[model samples]
Target chain A: MSQLLRQHIEKITPLTDSEFTYILSHFTPKKYKKHQFLVQEDAPVPNDFFVTKGLLKASYTNLNDGKEHILQFAWEDWWITDYQAYFNETASSLTIDCIEDVEVLCLSLHNREKICAELHKIEHFFRRKSNAGYVALQRRILSLLNSSAEERYHQLLVTYPQLFQRVPKTLIAAYLGVSRETLSRFSK
Target chain B: MSQLLRQHIEKITPLTDSEFTYILSHFTPKKYKKHQFLVQEDAPVPNDFFVTKGLLKASYTNLNDGKEHILQFAWEDWWITDYQAYFNETASSLTIDCIEDVEVLCLSLHNREKICAELHKIEHFFRRKSNAGYVALQRRILSLLNSSAEERYHQLLVTYPQLFQRVPKTLIAAYLGVSRETLSRFSK
Candidate 1:
């Protein structure tokens, strides 16, 4: 599992074995059963999870109509958290829960900052990650604003075929901001 | 104008006079007339602009319908670019144009990486900026998925009241993914 993290980071910035070990010491590993919540709305968010196994989702539940809006999903080699809550040190406005029994390496904001301040390479790695993540979110926002439901469905299918296999149709509909029937039609 | 960039960076990490001067040397000051495009779709994106004066928007034009969708607006102390193109060194997918006559400090990808590699504090500043940007994009995605047009209108009005004064109603409509008439109805 730690090798997963090492590889992920080394793809951007190579690390000496001792340096990787030092950085790895800052993270704690944890596990969760299926359907367990890693983060709950209005609770403080302290850690960002880097997934090593299984699948999970982060979502916002609309209070007025009780509808779920899927924000993101994470599986192996992915990261998940209520990042706004984590960075701001505020109560979360999203819930994150397991879609499968899960294992993740958790890094708290304190340790993240500590390691980033201590290591220039680690800081560069995170900066590059954040830049790429920013670009992905920008593309997603453009898709939501400009694409038709069918277009969005096709784009998702092309971008992450594995997601269609792993996620439920209803959850996929929520992520694409379409009705289940609309998604069904596109899939057919 | 240089002070704006210094202040923006200082908000995250304090810099010495010599450090700030060295960083500023990497940026070139440029001006654009209103309606001029900083970035054109399908053209190489060479620099990211830090706004020192006036306003601009980053948007995509849907080819089938010829409708524009606003992705972001930048004013004083804000950054704007085809970030996807800028980061990846690809042809732009979006067009960025000035809404008002604009003055900006431009940083190419090469200089950005150079400064970040050379200065740990600059890397920290950029990482923090990118994280904040990621969180803002997440909030926008949630709003797009969950909120009504009126709700989104009110949220934008509260968040950036000055935009209402400076940007045209039609552009505001594009930003909110609503018709101009619908935006007027909400404002009334």
Candidate 2:
């Protein structure tokens, strides 16, 4: 698990073994069974989870309609959290739960800041990650605004083909903001 | 203009005058007239603009329908770019243009990386900014997924009331993914 984190970080910045070990000490490894909640609405988000294994989703549920809207998904080498809540130290506006039995390394905001302040390279790695994440979200927003449901389906299929196999069709529909029947038409 | 940049950076991380001057040295100040393009689709994107005055929008045009989708708007103290193109050194997929006669401090990717590499605080500032941007985009995505056109209108109106006065209703409609008629109805 530590090796996984080291490799992930090293993709952006190289880390000596001792440095990797030092950085790894700030994270606490946690595991959850399928369907277990990692974050629940209105609860404090204490940490951001870096996934080593399994799948999870962060979603917002409409209070008036009781409909779930999928915001993001995380699997191997991805990070997941109620980022607004985590960064702002507020109650969560979304819920995160395991789609499969999961293993993640959890880093609290305090520890994250501490490590960032201590290691310039770690700070660089995080900044690069955040910049990449921002670009990705921008692309998603553009897709949502510009693409038809069918086009969105095809785009997602081509971009993250693994998602089609791992995520249920219904959830894909939720993410794409299309009805299941509509998504069926697209997939067909 | 330099003060604006310094204040923006200082909001996240304090800097000495010499340090601020050193940081400002990496940026080139540029101005654009209303409707002039800072970035055009299929052109290389080289700089990320920090808006010191006026407003600009980043948007995508649908090739088939000849319709536009507004991705983001930047005004005083905000940063705007074709981030995907800028970060990856690719041709732009979107167009960024001045909404008003604009003044911006342009920081090329090379300079951005140079500063981040040389100054840990600048990297920290950028990381913080990116994290906040990620959270904002996440919120926008959630709203797009869950809210009605009317609800979204009210959310935008309340959140950025200045936009209502400054931006044309047609562009606001574009941003909201609604018809101008629908936006009018919401306002009424």
Global lDDT of each candidate: 0.97, 0.94
Deviating ranges (above 4 Å) for candidate 2: none
lDDT of 1 by residue, B1-188 (tens): 99999999999999999999999999999999999999999999999999999999999999999999999999999999999999999999999999999999999999999999999999999999999999999999999999999999999999999999999999999999999999889989
Candidate 2 at A100: error in angstroms?
A: 0.7
- Residue-level lDDT tens digits of model 2 in A116-143: 9999999999999999999999998998
What's the fnat for candidate 2, on a 0 to 1 scale?
0.89
> Model 1: per-residue lDDT, tens digit, A154-186?
998999999989999999998888889988999
Per-model TM against the reference: 0.99, 0.99
**Candidate 1 lDDT score at position A52:** 99
Docking class of 1: high
Native-vs-model 1 lDDT?
0.97
